[model samples]
Target chain A: MTDLLPSPPPATRRPAPPGALSIGWARVALELRLFVRDPGQLVFSFAYPVVMLVIFGSIFADREVAPGVDFRQYFLAGIAATGIMLTSFQAVGLAITEERDRGDLVRLQTLGTPPLAYGIGKAGQVVLTTAVQLTVLLVVAATVYDVPMPDDAGRWLTFAWVAVLGVLAGTVLGIAVSSFVGSARAAGTGIPAVAIVLQFFSGVFFVFSELPGWMQQLAAVFPLKWMTQGMRSVFLPDAAKAAEPAGSWEHGTTAAVLAAWVIIGVVVCARSFRWRRNAG
Target chain B: MTTTHGAPALPAAASGERPAVQVRGLVKRYGGRAVVDGVDLDVRRGEVFALLGPNGAGKTTTVEILAGLRRRDGGSLEVLGEDPAGADRRWRDRVGVVGQSTGAGDALTVRETVDHYARYHATPQDSAELLDAVGLEGTARTRVDRLSGGQRRRLEVALGVQGRPELLFLDEPTTGLDPAARRQFWTLIEGLRDRGTTVLLTTHYLDEAAHLADRVGVIAGGRLVEVAAPGALGAGLRQEATVRWTEDGAAREVVTREPSAVLRDLLAAAPTGEIPDLSVTRPGLEDVYLRLVSEGASR
Candidate 1:
């Protein structure tokens, strides 16, 4: 029997002209647009930290047992440091794993977009989102909650360096963790679980001196502790140093530890990162 | 469509002229066993080359290597006169690909998806014109996740050709398309060929190969078993014709190499001048394909 449908007319459209932007810029723009359109991502990256800051700051505002420091100022610095970790680690890790699970990464490889472009776009998004989060947190801390600002230009510079170091460490660590996770769901849970434990022991929730000796040492090995301590040194008064064993800010040591973590994190990320989830 | 009735035939690849794509003694191994054996292929410029094989025959692996997405274990390969193993940005810009699966971002609309890919090439097609050419104008604002399978496939084709590539790879481009959609896609592909774009397509649908390809290659067990025109594959297979008719109110059929001879016989048998419901049928490309694949499987 003859088929009833009419045959389609031959196509007449012209081919795309040669000469366009490089694929790298196209990839970055696509990634940025997608990330911004996802409302859940925006809230988690920019709002969650502020919510935590307010709740934790209010709860610890009146607890005056620690010597030479007000609890609110100390936690504010710790919360800001934790916010950077959240953006870098949880944000980057889960996003990468989700994209992999969805087969987006594999699609990109076949399209001839280099793997490095994908990673760079992801890192750019994390850094931009973290910067916005930091700005929001600082505004709330300074204007609404009466959290003290850095006392001098030098202290402010130190705070800036600490934030940068914290974000770098977090981004590297997140990429590494994403490479290890089996699925997007696992990444979601695994990243936050590690972040919460680190926050508790890194003195974001309590003074590090109150922790057991081994717990203090264990926390010291992590980058979060150094980030928190460095931020506290910038915002907290000198009298607050009395609670610690040294009774003074060890800015050099904190800087060195964070720098070392950054190096190790970068190595792990580069060595372990996979472009496709199925890549062994 | 304006047919070129007297256009000159394209030149064949000479001994020293560079083939659009060349692969020699290519091999891909996993766990000590080669998935793609020592297969060799040559695709000349301005040719519609179809690579046909059954599932798990390593067609995808071969395409991936040609696309510069995977490394070959042992081979000398060249695409566009440069080694695909070390193809740089310039070489990449010359190639376009539509993989077996739909690879566009599902969250983006059709227009946005086309626009985004356009930026990847030094020169890209206009988004609206590309969409119209691909029959996607009505769904430009619709999200990819919401499009039907056929629409999504069209979008995939649009993205593949957005760069106006010198060479294009289509992996199972019409796998899930309805007959109408499939025919529409073929028209778009023909347009690409008209513009001097070389196309390399892989499909299980033999009709697709027969209709669109200038030459077809059968790949079996990771090897190039045979390559010829779609009608010329499987020697002696298409030589026979099956003639069917009604004799004395009952159906009758006969197979013979010469249908004209059979038609003469049918006219002699019938008392009247006209034969009853006569039809002459030849073996199709699908028959040759199945026979070849089954024979390869047994071996």
Candidate 2:
């Protein structure tokens, strides 16, 4: 007796092709499209900051906290700084933690996406979202809130530079914080907790001089203090600077400190970041 | 023929054939003990090679190293003729991997997921054709989170092949699939192999290995114990055939090295024209697999 079975087809051999795109723009487009599909994330990213700006603007309306510097002008720069922090630190950090928990990072690793590509994609998303947030806040400030806009090219350029710096600082800090937080829930709370505390001491809501000496020293260590201070330099006059403890705007020092923070934040994020939850 | 230790030596792929993958003296350690110990392997182009192992047998670690996701402590490894340790993006585009972790974005529709990956490769397969190939045409508009496990797995396979990769790594590609889904997945894999795709698969299911693999290698206790064609893995155990017959109003059993000889003897003893309820059985892949694993454990 004999038994016969169908034979497998003969193997066909071919050479493999080369890989492409070390840090491709297409990945950024993909991330942005996915982000927009989440209604909750979209609302929180774009609308939350604008709503806070409105509520705070109305509460401080018609008040002159410093001579020749009204509450509206003072709060405009502070609100913009806060918006950068919210979008870059809280938003990016929580999203990364959620993706890590969901095994998205592990999946991306298998696709041979270079690690630098992931960072570039994330930074692009943060910059784009922050630009929208800044535009909405500035429009409301200028048209509805009766805040003055910068007339000179120098001041407008300064405002643009400060916003860019704020974004870089916030993104680096957010990625660093994300490396330490293990779970999405912890990240959600921890990000907001750190942001709220920094806001208080950085003089976003109150005068920084009123805080205790040790508290003032602690706040100076954070990038938010220098970020808001630099933003205020673009919007406020020299005489108004008298109210600040440093008298004239410390523009040079603020730029230096913020740049240093950006460097430190990047180093921390690189050292501590893990592609997977259980990765060694 | 030149023999090594009185065993028929298998010929390695010839020089200039360009193995799809090669790993020599590979080792990985955890908690001061090696999980993968000095394993050597070569997979020829377009061959369906299966790695069979029990749970916690370091199969995952080995595959991860080949996929360039993990670093090996000691090994000379080459994937697609380049060292995976330092291969560039051009080298990566040649390989595809479907791991246990799913890469699909939960919010994106199935079509979007396939389309998004299509942009990453220079010569990607058409999105419509990829969806049809994976049997996901109906679910193209469905979000990944809403799809069933089988659908998600199919989506993963679609993404894995969209790059037109020459080498594909599938890690337990059929786990969690129902029998019908498993059969369907096998067809897709067979199609891929037919298209000249080299597949390196790891599966716990013996039937899956027996049905798809041209050659299977079994690993136990951090070591590769044996490698053979599925039918030849335990040929010694299959030497005896078991014949069962109904005789004298009772079931009778006999084991013999030669089934034809035994059948002739039984026919002569019964004196009956017809043998009642006659059945011939041989040892299967599962039986050989279980015996190999048990022996490995005992040693």
Candidate 3:
């Protein structure tokens, strides 16, 4: 073989193996750099939620969700939840669909990127982007819009776990659905439409209690609704609980629902996922 | 079908010259039609074997099977001595693929894209040098989407060699490159060959096969029709050359194998000792290829 390849295989393909952690980090670093370079994706993932918050926050300014809290604070929490979905689910779904269509996943497979490393690396992108997007939303809400920060240590703990659960559910769902999108261009329409549909029913843009009972039941079945309620529990004062359909945070249900979605995503992805070239 | 005689197929692993790739009775079906029907092939290590076929001729399908990128319905394939069907990372790491450039991560810069691919190999070639060799150093920071078709093909070549893999599969690697860039790419493949990398390539260009392949395989109707050295392909069909010249205020032409003897005879017979605008030509790979494909189509 050396006659065909002047260098020995041991020198090229067989050095001390890159441990799983290193390969994962390399993929994450590259994915993140690519995400940052695309201005359209940057604006959508980082700033779209803030832009939505500002527009709706002002329009609902005079309205009040509870005695002390106004629409701005109410929207602050819901929009933060929406930011997680946008950055994790929508962003990851679109990117993966496009990657699958473009043969990116296939190329990586051929290059021998370990499947675990690739999976972890993709999840890393979702986690990183959602973290940054949430930061941008919370910063703008607390600073520019006068939305109050969480004052209790336990509240921030809830926020952390909720964010993690929310992003996990969202990104896992994204990976599962990406296999169904037939082409890259089709993703532009499919992902945003699903997001919008979920947003409307999930009570991100409106009060969950005000929705019809059937819609509320439908919304309850989805992670976005639970994520929104979970974020509200972290940010809203106790009085705002009056506007929640359950009259309390329902923290147990939120965790259960999000965890269920995660399992469902994993199972569905295992069964139906098609990555790589079936190109004839 | 396109097996050309050069040296005998190099002795197998027992001879200290392993076959880089071997296929026996390979089969692949789509909706019950055989796309690749019972293909048997052998590519000796360090050899440049070009697979040539018209569209839908199973060339890509066979190459894909060899590269471990596709599954076969039946039959056996061994690449680097391991069946690609169950081949693992150790097998993949030694195989470099320059696939048809549907292109993934087009948003990544040329440098970034090549660099990411490099990490997959244990000891890749210098990313910077690879880019420069492909004439893409100027576009290193340019996103892949910004590259022209030719430039992207160059990037494909750059990444193909980045791994310094023992076996490289190049599928239509020069499809969109300009003549000069195609030549440049040929030079790069030659460099890889000289470095001892066994190459299995597929191309639509007969000239590319003529220029780069040690042996060329032609496929048609899901089976290999012939594999031969380029000069040997059309030899038996029409052995005569065409000699054309202007004489006596008119054009004249003759078909003969001995063009030089005819030229000598014509020069002696000419009153002015000249045959104007004279040329001697023979059939080439293209002629053989078109005949083979058309013959296959009719059959």
Predicted structure with the largest TM-score when compared to the true one: 3
RMSD after Cα superposition, model 3: 5.7
2 versus 3: better DockQ goes to: 3
The best candidate in terms of DockQ? 3
Tens-digit per-residue lDDT, B1-299, candidate 1: 11112322223357765678877777888777777888778888888999999888878888988887777787667787777777676677678888877456777888998887766655677788888878888999999899999998888877787777778899999997899989988888888887778899998778898899988888877887778988788867778789999878999899899999988877777768667789999877677788777776555
Q: RMSD to native for every prediction?
A: 7.8, 6.4, 5.7
Q: Which of the predicted structures, 1 or 3, would earn the higher lDDT when compared with the native?
A: 3
Model 2, docking class: acceptable
Which residue segments of model 1 deviate by more than 4 Å?
A1-28, A244-246, B1-16, B239-283
What is the interface RMSD, in angstroms, for predicted model 2? 8.6
Q: In terms of docking quality, how is candidate 3 classified?
A: acceptable
Residue B262 local lDDT, model 3: 90
Greater TM-score among 1 and 2 belongs to: 2
DockQ agreement of candidate 3 with the native complex: 0.29
Give residue B229's error in model 2 in angstroms: 1.4
- lDDT per residue, candidate 3, A123-164, as tens digits? 898899888888988899889888888899988998998999
- DockQ sort, best first: 3, 2, 1
